[model samples]
Target chain A: MDDDGRDRPPVPTGRSERARTAALEAALALAVELPYPQVTMEAIAARAGVGKATLYRRWRHRGALLVDAVAHRNARAAVGDGRIPDTGDLQADLSAVLRAVVDELAVPAWDALLRALCVEALVDTAVGAQVLEEVFAPQITLFARRFAAARATGHIDGSVGDVEAFELFVAPLFHRWQLRTGALDHAYADAVVRRGCRALSP
Target chain B: MDDDGRDRPPVPTGRSERARTAALEAALALAVELPYPQVTMEAIAARAGVGKATLYRRWRHRGALLVDAVAHRNARAAVGDGRIPDTGDLQADLSAVLRAVVDELAVPAWDALLRALCVEALVDTAVGAQVLEEVFAPQITLFARRFAAARATGHIDGSVGDVEAFELFVAPLFHRWQLRTGALDHAYADAVVRRGCRALSP
Candidate 1:
């Protein structure tokens, strides 16, 4: 949890942390209730029982705040939990982890939020960087560590590289979701792992 | 091909084909010279010496027109030539083909057009579907055919299935290009093929 990649802004102590959580909760509620275009800062402020000034002070704009809300949810507790179990079988471990990823992203609330932010991120460079930092940076770090451990255990070849090899697990899912090329389901998740693990086998 | 998937309306016999080609060239030339937002239908019409109404009758909007322009160029002859050689060595064949994909997609003109369309596609379903049809659909179909051929030759396992196996060839490339997580190059492209081949080997 180095400060370098931790995009989650530090919460203030005591009452402010509660307020931040309330604001985030309100943002998530609004995000699920309406299209992201309709989820406004004013609406969030009203829903959270806070002033617009409070939001501006923290996130600067609705997109930033929304990115934070969705990403914080994924990083902390929701879909995209980076805590994958190490069962010593690379194929099964990757398959299970990717299946969980599919499940997490499949949740309607998180999916909508994620899709909206992704669209905005494609258009806006700052938002694009936010996507990398908030959603993927931590999880990708965890992947590097996992891959290193897998390599050391002789489960996967050292040639898979430390970090880029993780792409085998995620890129296919992203390709399907981003391009609408196919269904993102358990079958697809396991297939990705199967091919990836096979490719990187010792 | 059948007109069902044809996004481009048929050019009338004689002079209309020339007009359509001019309009497409104008769109592509403008696409390279100016940002996508700056390159509009009005500008394209003036550049191509066609009326604004003519552009609208064919394409609903700028994004559709641009996607058609890029795809039409690719389909006619450009990047995404999936005419992979069957060297009987599936690994070498795949590596070569994937490397070509890397080169084709890396074209500055094509990349700019693709990237612009990608942002718009994320927000607009129509545009998103167009992205799949215009750019990826043909290649995916081609991939299925290749994998099937490989399976028959015993270069790959029979268990990999039809279309889902295609992801092994493409997902990593799409992931890198979309996320900017890493560079898309010949080395990376070859690595993807290597890993994919390993994963699917009997």
Candidate 2:
């Protein structure tokens, strides 16, 4: 949350906060409706009933606006501060977390939005970096925290790094989803969990 | 390679073969130079020194053209029939394969072209499916073949399906590359091989 005063606008007052929310909501709506490249700043401004100057003042480019918009939505949609539950059993927790992930991916609107974000990320590395920082990094950190707890309980090997270890479970789901290689169902999630548990064992 | 006669143009012969090569080469060249959405069919035709009619005769759309172009480049770039080498030592072979994969991903031009293909694949599900079937599926099959050999030699567990098991090693690499999560080096690749071997043990 280091504010260099470039990427983010000044802290908004109550009235401007509402306007900011409206602008972000409009951006997200247009994002899911149109391809990311086609979703222009002008369109978002018009959709939000704001002037072009107002939009530009807050966001430098369409990619920046879209990243913030998606980040906002992700934050709102997360369940209870977005921490993966550690129920003392790492396998069950991983299965439950991955199951929820697959379920979210099954929703068309959410999938489309995520696809758009992914396209934007690929198209612009700066956007990609922002997304990693604002979205995926926090989630990865939560997983790391959960892994630490699991390690304390002697559930996983102490030698394997949590970040790398977590990818054994999560990355396959992401890779499958990105490529449209197969169905993203509970079965696939469970299989990943099983493999992950086996891999992390001492 | 079932030809429904719709997805592919008539097999080129004699002089038309040159034109087909020219078009595909141009598509690949332009794909690396420009963002995928901006690489128009007209531009490709112009660059190839071929008429629009010649281009259209082969490919119905830009996506189709790009897919073939990328697939062609991939086939040619692949070393020795594109199979994961089965030297009877599964760990060393996987390490070698993954090491080569990371090397390929590091090449700037190749990375750009693959990024373009990935963007196109995300934008169009049809393109996505074609990329999987024509490109990734063959490679997956190769991995499956290697895993089958490994299983026979007792290198891995028999209970896990080869297709699903292969993801433990490959998907993490793909995910890391796509997300730019970390440095994809020999070190990362070797780490994955270690985790993969541990995960796949009987």
Tens digit of lDDT per residue, candidate 1, span A1-202?
Answer: 3364335544656786777777888999999999878899999999999989988888878888877787667666633554566777777877877888788678887677777887667666687777777777767877787788898888888876654778888888988887888888999898788778777778
> Model 2: per-residue lDDT, tens digit, A1-202?
3354222333556786777878889988887787666678899889999888988898788877877886676566653146788778888988988898899889787788888888878888998898887777656777888889988888889988866876888899998998877778999999889888888887
lDDT of 1 by residue, B1-202 (tens): 2365443433546576677777888999998898778899999999999999989988899888887787766666533554556777887887877887788778776667777888778777888898888777777766777787888888888987655667777888877776777779999988888888877888
Question: Mind giving the per-residue lDDT tens digits that candidate 2 earns over B1-202?
Answer: 3364222333556687878878888988887777667689899989989899988887878877887886666666653245778788898999998898899899787788788778878888888888887677667777888999988989899988865777888899988998888889999999899888988898
Deviating ranges (above 4 Å) for candidate 1: A1-19, A78-82, B1-12, B104-109
Worst 10 residues of 2 chain A by lDDT: A1-10
Using all chains and alpha carbons, the TM-scores for the candidates as numbered come to 0.89, 0.89
**What lDDT does each candidate get?**
0.78, 0.80
TM-score of chain A of 2: 0.86
